[model samples]
Target: MPLLDAARAVRENAHAPYSRFKVGAALRTTTGAVFSGCNVENVAYPEGTCAEAGAIAAMVAAGETRIAEVAVIADSPSPVPPCGGCRQKLAEFADGDVVVTMATTAGQSATLTVAELLPGRFAADHMGNG
Candidate 1:
């Protein structure tokens, strides 16, 4: 299935209520497996999970640590960029040049790299210490 089709299909399962902003993400892993996730919102705004995060969680749960491609879709006029936390999480599994595709409900689309989305990201290696 096309990336867009996978994203659109997953978007339908989004559990968004407060924001009514549904998002979906499909990630292709280095193991040739595709994992899909949908945004799950909570009453507490900060507790909500982004689509990309969910997809990564699913991949990790399945023991897949590397991502080759990721496609995110939302019901917006323009492409929705991943949040800071999601960007950091993505850097853990995907390198700077990993394909990052964004799409909107109206068919608008854009592509970028993890590095372009989050420049100078601090990874686990940068943890602990001054």
Candidate 2:
């Protein structure tokens, strides 16, 4: 399925209530596996997880890493960029040039690279700083 179609289908499963901001994400791994996820919110706010994180979690749960492409969808006029936390999380499994596409309910869309979304990101290598 096309990335947009996957994102739209995943969007239907969003469990958002507090902000009423639903989001969906689909990721295609280098191994040719497609994983999808939707935003899940909590009344506690900070416990909420973004769609991108959900997708990554699913991928990890399935024992797969290294994403090649990712698409995100939101029901807003402007394309929704992934949150800072999500961006950082993406860097853990995707290369700096990984393709990230964002889409709006009205069909507007934009594509960017992981590096473009999160510049100067700290990754696993930074954890061992001596």
Candidate 3:
């Protein structure tokens, strides 16, 4: 749960004044490098950055791809997984079976694979990458 802990720590920096709903994300590369990020909301309301996107940006900035694992934490009754757009964003770096752990600040958590979280996801193969 160290990843979740890291995410929770960054949640304090989340800029979510609009919704007052803060979120944090932490991701581990296959090489074991960890990157963390917090959601930054915008006044425009619709166009806001997600915690997962921030973490992915950090990971890419560190010159790494291929997410081996991910952890997301939020202050909710149940563990909240990444949003629909984030699931696609995660798929860009994570494999179908990559582990994604959703956690709540209250200690509740749920673990699932990317495939489980986003079944029938639009993957690289669909884009003819192969």
Candidate 4:
């Protein structure tokens, strides 16, 4: 299935009682496996989970460490990009050239590479682990 379709499908399952702003994300791993997730809200706003992070966690739980492509969808006026934290999470598993597609329910969409999404991204090398 298309990543966008997957994301859209999962968006319906999002637990956004507080914000009512549901979001969904899907990612294709380097191994050709696809994983998807939806935003899960909590009473404590800061405890809410973003769709991208949930997708990444699902991918990691499946033992896939590399991402090839990603797609996210939301019901907003324009395409919605992942949050700062989620962007960094994506960078942790995807190369700079990996494509990230952000979309809106209205059909608007934007495509960018991970590098474009998070320029000057902090990496493991910054921790002197590389």
Off by over 4 Å in 3: none
Tens-digit lDDT string for candidate 2 (41-116): 9999789889999999999999999999999999998999999999999988999999999999899999999999
lDDT of 3 by residue, 1-130 (tens): 5788889999999999989999999999999999999999989978899999999999999999999999999999999989999999998899888999999999999999998988888876788995
TM for every model, in the order presented, reads 0.94, 0.95, 0.96, 0.98
Error of 3 at 50 (Å): 0.5
Give per-residue lDDT, candidate 1, residue 46: 79
TM-score sort, best first: 4, 3, 2, 1
Alpha carbon lDDT of each predicted model: 0.91, 0.93, 0.93, 0.96
Q: Pick the candidate with the highest TM-score.
A: 4
After the best TM-score superposition of candidate 4, give how far the Cα of residue 49 lies from its true spot, in angstroms: 0.5
Candidate 4 residue lDDT tens string, 6-41: 999999999999999999999999889999999999
Q: Quick one: RMSD of model 4? A: 0.5
Better model by TM-score, 1 or 3?
3
Off by over 4 Å in 2: none
Number of the candidate with higher lDDT, 1 or 4: 4
